[model samples]
Target: MKYLIVHDAAPGQFIHIYKHLRSEGHEVVVASRRGTTHRLPVKQLVYELPEELKGSRSGYTAKVIGLGLSLYEELKPLAFDGWAPDVILSHASRGASYFLRDLFPRARIVSLFEWYYGAPNPDTGMDEGAFRQQAANAAATNMPISRDFDCMDAGYTPTLFQRDAFPKSWHRNLEVIHDGIDTDFYTPANKRAIEVNGKRFRKGDEIVTYAARGMEHTRGFVEFMAAISEVQKRRPDLQVLIAAADRLCYDPGEKGKGLKSFVDETIDYDRERTHFLGLVPEAKFVSVLQVSSLHVYLTKPFVLSWSLLNAMSVGIPVLGSASAPVQEVISNGDNGLLVSMDDGQALADAMDHLLADQVEAGRLGRAGRETVIERYGLAQCLQRQLDLMRG
Candidate 1:
């Protein structure tokens, strides 16, 4: 089958599937804006957007709606180039193929959606920003994506939490499939020592791991820091290994300040014991997890992080936020432990308990690894995605 991917410059959501498709003799073409399209193994048709279409007072969804039209315009010649695609896959948040329905009328278009958000964000389900007062803005914010979705042949969400976030009317139309974890690559390994920024952590080190977690409110970074610091007070030998960009991706902060500095100013943690590896490579990250006594993941009611699954795949005990999304993956005291997103004391207690009780931690770690292998295996995810593309 011929496949065409519409995406932004960053590595796409279906990268592995596309590479596998190419390996299996399927022709794939990616029409993307200029960032990281070079990573794809398939042919690519890159386009540049006009300056004005690049950004606006509106959010990324709005910006992409404008950019999608430009992409459609750029690909107009493909209608006569004899490079017709059997299916089109795109990230709904990114600029996708819009206004090309007439050109590729026979092509099946599928949009991959993550979680949905509105004025009164689910994280702060407070009295402020009532849906009624913000209804118009919210609808307009969602209008472009909704309109594009209406024209799709199928909609896909990686989790049931995400699918259910869509209107109840669209639930039946969307299917849940995980992006999957490479168990073979992420599995536990025995190591004598791992080094990061000149600090070497050995097998006996009581390392607490956090990964790909920006210092933001949504990820509950503040809570994690506080909880871990409390644990540190009790366990003086405990060391923290964090791998993430110091920037805030989901929350607005003061200009010229990374959340690391903000977090330092607000939260009191042992700086000497904490090693900020600021987004380490995959090898280093896995090594960190392999030596970890416990891994901590905290998030609001938002899209779940792949790092959480990666840590689990490494057979490490995970203490995650008890939000709906995290709860879906972690069964407290079974596969993994969880506490309320904002309950700093609860998070600290869980961390301390898991770190102290190695036997119980090992059991949870093994169960967590079993869960990932059974449910989110890489082979199974690829097969399901291949089926989606075929349809």
Candidate 2:
């Protein structure tokens, strides 16, 4: 079937889903504002937004109303040229769904619900009033998407956490199918000898911790740092390797920015135990996981990170935050260990325990790999998506 997917096209969740749909033999077209220059394997249809609309304020009420008209005007011609679509799958909520429905009256329009308003902002320090206003705008804008649910053929979400976030009435057409991982690319490997940044790391010597692009409050970077310090105090020989995409570089004098500089000032950097390698290739990331003795993944109650799942696929013992999506995947003391969201001591203790007991860690890692193979593998996810579309 021909499918048109509208999303931000950032280097995260949506990209994997895009690639997966293409691999399943669907004629996929991505409508995105970012990564215009980045080459993708499938057919891509770009939508350019004005600078004002693409800014952080675009989610506001006035800004969305203005941008909605502009987006409709820009995408009309592309929809005609593409011969319309069999199904228009959108992650951009109401605006894109409404525009697509107007353009392709015959096509089934499905929206992927990654988030909803009214939920607590996982990011700390966000002004409540501003956040509430953003939510209000989102609710207003997303009405079109929700309204189309009955008219459209079907809708799908990656997790139950996302589905339950919406009102029960709106989720009538929603189906929960996980955005799965490619097991071949992220399979279990022997942690013998691995190198990062020209430094050789042995299996038991290095402990790799990871967080992605946004190092903001939502990702629990501060808590990860605190946990690292706690672990270091006990195990002085531990070498912490941090692999991140967007490393926060803050001004030294900023009082309460909640930036990376704040972490630098609080932690004892002189020990030289922590190394931050900014944005390595995918192969290198898999290699880091292969050689890691223990991997710490901390986050607030947001969408689960793909890295954690990738690590699990590779049979690396993961210590993740006990939040919604993460908790759904990790069963404490089973496949992987789960710790409280802001509990630094618990995170540190779990890390130390996993590291000290290699036998138990190996067992958990093996179990995690089995779970990925049995349930969350690419084949299973592909079949589920096909079923969703066919239904």
Candidate 3:
């Protein structure tokens, strides 16, 4: 079978399937924005909008359409060479492959959606200005995603929570199949002293870890720090390690400003104990988790992050926000603990409780690892993706 993979970037989550198809003697091609994948067949796509068309900041919808059209122009050569794929697995882009349908009419296009950005978190009371910004953001991001959904033969989301976020009409076409984690790579490590970024993190050290792609409001960084502040007052020996860059992934309010401006200015942080290892390598990230007494993850009903699962896979007790996507994975007091993101004192209390109760923490850690192995393990998910891509 001829399988084509379309993504804003690849072989991201699709790496396992991409390698599998080639080893199985199937014709596979990847089209993405990356420059090269060494031996793998790929058509690198890059299109810069003309400066003359960069007139208004209000024309975000038009700008996104240009990006989609650019993707189509870059990918037509594959079809021109009489190499139309039987299936296309497109991921996380605003109709990047929607125009490809004209060339590969027979191919089944399955778009992988992380989440449909429907509305801002209900708890976050929006003023008139905030409401207008939310609407504009939707136009720039969600509008294009809606276009992709309209053209896809099927939609695949990682979790049921994410699937349910889409319009009710799309539910029939949507399927939930997580791009799973590598169990072997992310396994329970032997507890020991590990040195990272010139800091020696010793075993038995009271350390709390927080990780995300960036330090932003959406990831609950501000609230995490607030909780951390409370925990600091309780545990004098506790050390905090944050593994993310100072930037915004979501939350446009924090974009132009940085970590200094993004986080709540009033939260009293234990700056001496707090270490911000800005965007460490994956191996280092694992080291941080390995030394962690407790791992904290939070999201505002947004796309589920891999760091949370990675910490779980690493066999550490994790505390996640009680948001829809997180609640889907963590069973409070069982596999993992959960807290309302709005309640900073409650979060701090949970962290303090976990730290004090090592026996319960260990149990939760083991259960969390078991959850990952059984549900989101790579072996099963890879097979499912292979079937979909080869269909």
- Give me the candidate number with maximum lDDT: 3
lDDT of 2 by residue, 17-55 (tens): 566667778787666654443567666555555677656
**lDDT rank, highest first?**
3, 1, 2
Worst 10 residues of 2 by lDDT: 248-257
**Tens digits of lDDT, candidate 3, 8-111:** 65667677877777788877777665353344554444544445545566376666666567767776776687878888777756556657677688888878
- Against the true structure, candidate 3 reaches a TM-score of 0.90
Local distance difference test scores for all models: 0.79, 0.70, 0.80
Worst 10 residues of 1 by lDDT: 250-259
Model 2 quality (TM-score): 0.84
Q: Candidate 2: where are CA atoms >4 Å away?
A: 10-26, 35-37, 41-43, 51-59, 65-71, 78-82, 119-152, 191-193, 247-258, 269-271
Task: List all candidate RMSDs to the true structure.
Answer: 2.8, 4.3, 2.7
Best TM-score goes to which candidate?
Answer: 1
lDDT winner between 1 and 2, please give it. 1
| Sliding window of 10 residues with minimal summed lDDT for model 3 | 34-43
